[model samples]
Target: MDVRTLEYFVAAVECGGFTKAAARLHVTQPTLSEAIRRLERECDAPLFHRVGRGVVLSEAGAVLLTYARRVLKDMEDARQSMIALRGFQGGRVTVSAPPALSIEPLARIVGNFRRAYPDVTVVMLPTEDGALAAAAVANAASEVGLTDRPVSADLRAHPIGSNEIVVVLPPGNALSGKGPVSLEQLAGVPFISSAVGTRARNLLDESKERGIALQTAVETPHREAVIPLILEGVGAAFLPWTVSREAESRGAVVLPLLPRVAYDLLIVHRDQPLTAAAEAFVATALGSSPVGGD
Candidate 1:
């Protein structure tokens, strides 16, 4: 019936008598007896057989005793798990992000969170662009998301920082030392472009509407290959400043774009109560310094 009733029944069975169970439970014997009577009435079966100076369990009593112990144990385990989650000692949080954001702020935040809460597991779900990342959070696929912008109205966004878009060129290109390259200069230049729906591709498409065109020498969906392609002089590509810096260290020339194209980085989630692990993750992300070009 109720947890307290089950507890009383179990105590009586374990102590072999209502009198001893009442003593152990710090309850009056009459109170314990009444509780057990109520339980038996609810079940429509006798739980005990009276024997002189002691009691023996009925057939129904044996079945009820087994289940009662399991229920109590399960309740206790649930309580302990909640405590662990609240204390940030255990649990997992899932986060979704595009590749560019994942490289800068998200990667830095995850590293910091893991160091502080080593017991908490962080799961990453990769998406192609800001819209997909926002959709993942809206559909409950992830608890947190990092994106260039939030596309879903149902989600709330936190401004973490911004990443400046930069140009990545092969070593010894003519435009390498020409200060910040303008959109006009890139017209007719061979470029390594990502898929159409990517942030960089979308920006380039918008630029095309304004009469500035970039010729695509190669197009691929895999962003990891963009830097490698640039290294081999396949074509120049656009990348976030943080990623371009890494490419620069590896012999690729990095230059800022004219007019300083930058995208706002956001952390998004549904407007509802979050689990303790997710809350901690959001707090960690908000507290960390902004990464990438200012």
Candidate 2:
């Protein structure tokens, strides 16, 4: 049977009635009815059972529905594959990243990819944390992602680089004059830190295990707020070197932490095959400079 007739049959079965399906397909009821009639004749059995106002699929129709939907989905997949084979000239790739990461290497890589594939659209999906970013790729909401934390076993992850986590001090603070601040020097100091359960927060927690008890002045979920809080003289905080560099011009002093703590940066995606656009983006990211090193 022709794909159009099969589409009409499936639509009729889904819409529950010929008239409703006709309205949905934007075809006249007679035309839809004729198509289903032809479909039934070709199959040598009735496809639907008539009820008072609607219709239900017959036993034969029930069996055909399964294969019919699969066939249609396969056809669509073939079409997409053809388009992807065209070097993603007019395709779209959805990516997910933490709000903080979307600004840096991720944004730079996305920009570079766009320049190369001007016709392809790159959509950024927002995620709050590394876990959420990994979930987006795992669940197929995003094809690829950048995250600070390790993802589950199902995904492929690559260590792009590491960034030195530094102590951000307010302008003219006593610690600002110190070349490198140590955990012991920071002990009991009022600190502005990331919210609990974050990578940055976990770093602070790990330091506590080494006998550094930081007095948290305020905890914020927004990474953007850390520099501003430090500039306002609220408290000191540990931040990635890339981020702290920007805060330097805003009157914040960035000093390396004494223990030389650093966070590893990663690029993640599902183990499944990537589309052309996703492959290109990942390639660019792999070639880009690592965090703090750039």
Candidate 3:
């Protein structure tokens, strides 16, 4: 199969549609469609299933996607290797991280990395799911990932730091005066929670698993809205201690959970070899100094 065809196929999966992929590749829709068709013919199987106005990957397509990404990544790595032999002048490193958990430190790290290596371009992939952080690295879509969740055994992860998860309450709420509130105490109160699949949502699920039937007052995807909603007396919610500290100054009462919970931030990458720029990033993040420091 032609590498170009595989490139088009992967682009379709990432962009979510042929038209979008075509626009992304700066190619005509017909050209993109023809390339995908050729790929399907070579594989002798339909890779995508037409659903509504868009297409979803078929079982065959999903299988092909995994190998396609590896092949593309290998090709890129080979090219970057040659570029590095001459001089490490210009190279790109893509990094992914869970959105809510990594806002502060990752931003600092990226800012520092750019200032230190001005010629090295850093691409930050936007992702909300914490799991995607590690998956991005495994799939070769990104060179490295910053995640708060555990990575699979096939991947290598480095401990960066940890963040405390705390409960936030409104000023007039009964729990406001409490020092450390147990999940049991908040069981009767309506709970504002992060949306499904997010780390905060996982904590809420953990509470339920522990036998606390916390009523869902509101479920939102907006991490920024969590404190504001609590301040408005919408309901209590759990947030990172650093974030909760900011809310505490703004009239929201921050209290530690009965059983303290903290998630470790890890720098994750595939077990396989990484490009030079990726290794540099890993070293910088793992170093004792602040992200981007000498």
Writing each residue's lDDT as its tens digit, candidate 3 over 143-217 gives 789887888998999987777778888877766666888788888777788978865688888888888888889
Compose the digit string of candidate 1's lDDT tens values, residues 1-294: 999998899899878999999999999999999999999999999999988866889999988876787566445445545856566577778899988778888889999999988988899999988788887777565778998864667788988888888888898888877879888988887888888877678767777789987888998988899999999999998888977887899898888888898878889887866667777889999999987575
Q: CA shift at 54, candidate 3, in angstroms?
A: 3.6
User: How many residue pairs clash in all the candidates, one count each?
Assistant: 0, 0, 0
lDDT of 1: 0.83
lDDT of 2 by residue, 196-222 (tens): 776568778887887778888998887
Q: Candidate 1: where are CA atoms >4 Å away?
A: 1-86
TM-score of each: 0.70, 0.70, 0.87
TM-score ranking, high to low: 3, 2, 1
Model 3 has how many clashing residue pairs?
Answer: 0
Q: Which candidate is the best by TM-score?
A: 3
* lDDT measured at residue 261 in model 1 versus the true structure, 0 to 100: 86
Q: Which pairs of residues collide in candidate 3?
A: none
Q: Cα lDDT of model 3 overall?
A: 0.81
- The candidate maximizing lDDT is 1
